[model samples]
Target: MTETITFNDLGLSEGVLAGLRAVGYETPSPIQAATIPLLLEGRDVVGLAQTGTGKTAAFALPVLSNLDPYETKRPQALVLAPTRELAIQVCEAFEKYAAQLPNIRVLPIYGGSAYGPQLTALKRGVHIVVGTPGRIMDHLDKGTLDLSELRFLVLDEADEMLSMGFAEDIETILATTPEEKQVALFSATMPRQIKALTGQYLRNPKEVQVKSKTATAANITQRYLMVSYPQKLDALTRILEVENFEAMIVFARTKSETDTLAEKLRARGYAAAAINGDIAQNQREKTVNQLKDGSLDILVATDVAARGLDVERISHVVNYDLPTDVESYVHRIGRTGRAGRSGDAISFVTPRERWLLKAIEKHTRSTPAEMQLPSVDEVNATRLNRFDEGITNVLAEKEKISFFRDVVAHYVSENDVPELEVAAALAAMLHGEEPLLLEPEPVRPQRQSRDRDDRNSERGERSNRAGAARTNDRGDGQPMASYKIQVGKRHKVEPRMIVGALANEGGLRRADFGNISIRPDFSVVELPADLPQEVFDALAQTRISGKLIELAPDRGAPNRRTGERFQDRPARKPRRKD
Candidate 1:
């Protein structure tokens, strides 16, 4: 619970303590506290911890502390990670924690980028090299990376590496290293492959497992708002207007999205900036410093860029987009609710991502309470309250108000207006542009059915269909409406493709659809009668394989009696005038 701890307890060097302080690391995490001592004793270590548990420091601290700064840079430390993202993250951590050690240099090598920079870094001699297996193997074969003098070899996220099919590559890299090298393997889980590797490579390793705390912070309140994509931005703006957050971090999935969302927030008058992989390191540090110092109120960032970032002033964490993994969700929310401080985490879950939200709740073992979108009246009430507070504070302060009073008098006289009119004009000016807040569209909740037999019967009929043509009835014994898409059998579209696209874009559950009829020209999907507007809007925006829905009504024989056409009229051509 405390951030500061004695490095002597961890058996680390004074120089390492100095370096840690330089990087603002006041204490060690549970994993770091247990593994650092054993690693500094020159014994192999096996650490089991989840992501964002300070696993990097668990290994990096001891490895850096034990290394002789005067030793020749022949790659004394080698760290292997699963992906390019993880490799870069570990290398950055090493660089930050070792900032005070002038002789310490770290290099990250990974694919999907150029090899020129990596080759240059290796040739210049680095004290530590963190890389992915494939790229590290490539460097080894090129004779560009020399690990014969390696004193420490670390396999970060060993389970993920194995899952990514890097066992052979790992073996090759380990074979190239010195047999007497101290090895440390860390993973979230120890599958059989990882255990076998440990038995073969690590010699009498000290095992350290840090179990996750079962209880989250009670002071931290969690809630989620069900919203459609078009309404999420509006909902977020409304929340920010009402919530009294000191500083907040909004998490998005991609770099581009972070930038875009930050710009939108700034346009709405909130002090905001984007922090992503594309931003320079210095700029990222400056942005964070500004947020801490109260110059900025909102920071939009992707997960990778925001990792290991601890800011005590962060009062809220908004998940602008649901994370793809449960681990990511934990890390995102962990940014707030620190040091016994109460915080709030709000997630906007679209209908399609409801399953992911459920997964997160199950993984965290804490269900987030659902909330409705804030109404316009609520936002206005909050604004009015803030205005009254501002006036009260001004009255309480011992500041000069004669100048403001004179200006108001002058304005009233020049416009030949009443004092109240002058005040109203001032308020309108203060509100700035876009004063009318838009109301968010409502989202309907999923329906629950208790009839298992009827549900299974409908599912069986859907599964047994052999062709792309079928008319299906709902589990409730009602005929569903069917619509055809322009793309069909010739488009190489499968029933599952249609199903997934609909589920993802249309926010429709798998049960909402009765059957999929795929054909050469297009496909037909069955839906409940009188579908909600939100569902219809989502379908209109759905894109499958680079094609828009372009859906027209499917007036099959069943609907002929209703006088409905099978296809809607095409867009009218403008009068072909000269």
Candidate 2:
């Protein structure tokens, strides 16, 4: 068994400590506490822990500590992840942890983005390269990414990479690396493929497994509110008006989103600040310190940037965007309810993201209570109650008020306004922009019966009947009308993506949609049969997966024969430089 340890006992350099302090990491997590020591001793390690258990740090700290800075940067450490999202996340963690280590650049290379920047960064010589297997292989083939000086090779989320069919690519890449390099592998599960890979590549690896625990703090009152994308801001504002939270942390998905949300919250008069990857380390530290000292009430942050943060004053954790994965959900909620304090975790789940919520519940083995959006009346009543309480507090304080009383009397006499009217005006001024509480939109849960049936149905029958069935009408007898959308297989969209986009952007429940037929260049969707022109127009304006959707009457043309086959489409024209 590995001995228990602390961050100080791990022998990390002062530069790493500075980075850790900037992020408020006072102690090591269980996984980090266990795995760092062996890895620091230059032993190959196989770590068994789920995401969000600080696995990144378990390997990152040791790698940074053992590296020789004076050595040429031909990629000393290489981390391979399955997806672009995971690759970026791991790179971000390394960057944040190694902030004070000058000349130790970390780069992430993935598809769905330009490769020029990645190539440039590689040519400049980065010490660590975290990337998806395909893109990394591309660089390796092109002679852009050099691993000649590599000392450590880490396979993060090994099971995920194998599931994504990167086994051959991983093997090929590992074959190119030097035999002297230390190998570390981490995975949530030890599947047969992962085990096989470990047996083939690892050298007497030290195994460290964190027992999966389904323990969530009893003090946390977890709840979730279902709302559409546009209504989310309004719903969140309403909740802020009603809930009496001391300090809160709002989690977003990206750096831009954090800033956008923070600005919106600030405009609404909340003491808010954003913390994301783009912010400088010193400024980020200052913001967190201010929040701890009660000067700032809310902090908006992304998951990677918020890692290692521990603040006792955070009374609530608001997931502004539902996490992309279960591990992220666990980490986001874990920000609150620390140090034996009771806290609240509130998530706003768009209809499309309900699946992710369910996944989180399955992984955490804890369900969040469903919460209804706060009504306008509820918010207004709470605001008035708070106002009254403030007045009471002011009155309770022993202070001579003769000067204020004289000034108010004079103003009332001079303006011929009632005392109540004067007080109301003052309250309005103090409240800033007149409080216009929004009416909460009615939330209808997505119907999962069809989805459940689809999952259980035989593949052959489901594909054959894809275009034949029609969804049941509501209380009315009219069958929903079928309309053709301009995007389909050519757009590389799946049924779930289409469903999620519609539910998120159009504010339509899953039940509102009927049979969906995906074809080469277009799709047919059953919308409300007698939908008003406004609804049709709204649907026309909707964009899904970043493609504008034009709605037209179904031509009764077989969806399969609508347009050019997806595989035969003309090559995309390259863009001109500005």
TM of each candidate vs. truth: 0.52, 0.60
- Cα lDDT tens digits, model 2, 479-540, are 57566778888777567656644554344667777778998888978776544453444455
| lDDT per model vs. reference | 0.77, 0.77
Local error of candidate 2 at residue 558 (angstroms): 8.3
Cα TM-score of candidate 2: 0.60
lDDT of 1 by residue, 338-425 (tens): 8889899999887767756765675577889998877777888887788888878877765566678899998888988999988887
**Which number leads on TM-score?**
2
Misplaced by over 4 Å in model 1 are 1-5, 24-27, 71-73, 218-267, 271-315, 319-343, 347-364, 367-578
Q: Pull out the clashing pairs in model 1.
A: 468-517, 468-518, 489-519
Tell me the alpha-carbon RMSD of every candidate. 12.7, 10.3
